[model samples]
Target: MSGNSRYRILFAGTPDTAVPSLDALVGAGFTIAAVLTRPDALVGRKRVLTPSPVAARAAELGLPILRASRLTGDAGRETLGRIAALDLDAAAVVAYGALVPAAGLEMPRHGWVNLHFSLLPAYRGAAPVQHAVIDQAAQTGACVFQLEEGLDTGPVFSRLERDLQPGETSGAVLADLAVSGAELLANTMGAILTGTATAEPQRGEPSLAPKLNQADGFVDAARPAAAVAARINGTTPEPGAWALLEMASAPAEEAGERPAQQRVKLLGAVPEELPEGTADLPLGDPLPGHLHRGRTAVHLQCADGTVRLVQVQPAGKKPMSAADWARGLPEGTRFQAEATAETATEGP
Candidate 1:
């Protein structure tokens, strides 16, 4: 302890997920020198420029704020210079989007410890939480580790594991972890500041979780129903899982344009079981992404089984039950990667 006082540290992160850790540090009586976050940028559907969640939280705490941008070359150097002037005992990072070059990493006395949202040596990169859900991982958790130049290849201080539940979206799972991890992070800090914590290099082969894109949310009919459900869960409340629901037969319009596809975001779903008296369920024979109805539910065929879309939001429309959508569809409609104008020529 510095003169039996709270450890003076720097907090750096940008997203809402990172807010809890900073708040925990304050609760633990850490003297935060300054909070560093990415510069405010355009956000939301209306594209409003807004401060990062970390910056806003810092403001509420009355902590000094440092707005950093595009951490590279001269800009990186300038930011490092300002950080050095703060004379931090340690720096704690959680979900900070920018990579801290080794130059900045080496400046602190205890070095920078990152609160990564994963068990080290697995899913070791950005978007780990979402990747874990997409991959249907049975378990995942948080790791408090020292930051190194090679991705998440750092020495681990502590970890807190959490189970992945069926149909639980990454957003929900992470919300739980972000709050719990904050306490784990605060406890780990107390040990480090008092010189009791140990750092061990991560073990096992590491898997990379590259950043996800819009294409990742595309639900393919060729995948298993369980896989589709996982994709929907993984991508929900973000870029979102989507499908182009269509049919084989349709009235031809004089304009010759392919009818605009029903672009619906998958918010919730469940694997469908063969209902009583239903024929032996076809896992693969049906056209993949084909839509069907069972009295009150909407079912989509996949390579291995069927899934019921519970909640969906059509683009430009409010969310509604998938059953309601199915009620309006022709008996044998299917989903496609994209509809073609040429398909309009196909007979009913």
Candidate 2:
């Protein structure tokens, strides 16, 4: 068969990050036999049912769609049967959110190809891009690999690398990768159809990047300023990094009364560096968790140094400049100190 349209294939994905690859495949002239995505989920405060981004896009493109929360038991059998009926030459997966069954793996002649955010044999698992930022990785990129049952342990077909920029959030890096990775996915698909694709075993030691939870987003000032900055940026636009702001008690209140605490999301964080000859200024170094507000900005002291809070979002409020938020703070107000033991650490 000649040309991409001659090869029938299935496209499986979910989330906004996966939409680009689906579009790229269609633009590359692939005959997308069908699209598989997760079932509609309850989203937002109202709990309205919402279709996955891929499912919604597939609907817009007028392509057949298969929705499954998971491919297991009877649902797995039915979906697999339906997929098999398409006589697919191969399948392309990008953040599909679920694992493919062993039976489904053999249905495609060229097997299933996955577009993972991180290079193979390194940072393998869900949340690769997030973990890469948190761990301060020098570089990270995308890989198109043959998918098996293991957790991102697959032979690679093609790969692309990009350097991680300082102070860049995981969300920003992932968004960039999603676009560039879409092109990589489409090229790999074309190569596979033309029988020019080569699969090679992954090299180097492996690292795990498990999914992060709400607790992972807690920003502890006890850690070094760089680590605190990394954690805050890595968790941004998702679970969201936040710190506890302690309110000062009134002067007439009981001597031993505890201060009230408010949760505030730390949207933009970066290590602060004092200008030359400013060391002798009255601001001298503040204790960890203490706030130092200047005319133009607000800085929070950490273990080694201080981090500038560029933007902050108070509970139930929109994000605002740290300087604006600090203007109304009580004289003794500061961030609540968190125990180092409660902080989240990267897995080996």
Model 1, range 1-348, lDDT digits (tens) per residue?
Answer: 443145779999999999999999988888899999999999879999999999999999999999887456888889899999998889999988889887888888999999999898999888899999989899999999999888999999999999998788888998899999999998898888889999998999799988888898888656767888888888876668888876545453345656546777888777776465443245734556667666777777766667878887877988898878667776546687332333322321
Off by over 4 Å in 1: 1-5, 247-249, 253-260, 277-285, 337-348
For 1-348, candidate 2 gives per-residue lDDT tens digits of 337888898999999999999999999999999999999999988999999999999999999999987778898789889999999999999999889989999999999999999987888988999899989889999999999999999899999999987678888899999999999999999998788999999999999989899999998887888888888889987779999998988843476777888999998688777434423236655556888777778888777777888799999999999989999998778887675433423222
TM accuracy, model 2: 0.93
Please name the candidate that would achieve the greatest lDDT relative to the true structure. Answer: 2
Instruction: Estimate the TM-score for candidate 1.
Output: 0.89
Error of 1 at 20 (Å): 1.0
Candidate 2 least-lDDT 10 residues:
339-348
What lDDT is obtained when candidate 2 is compared to the true structure?
Answer: 0.87
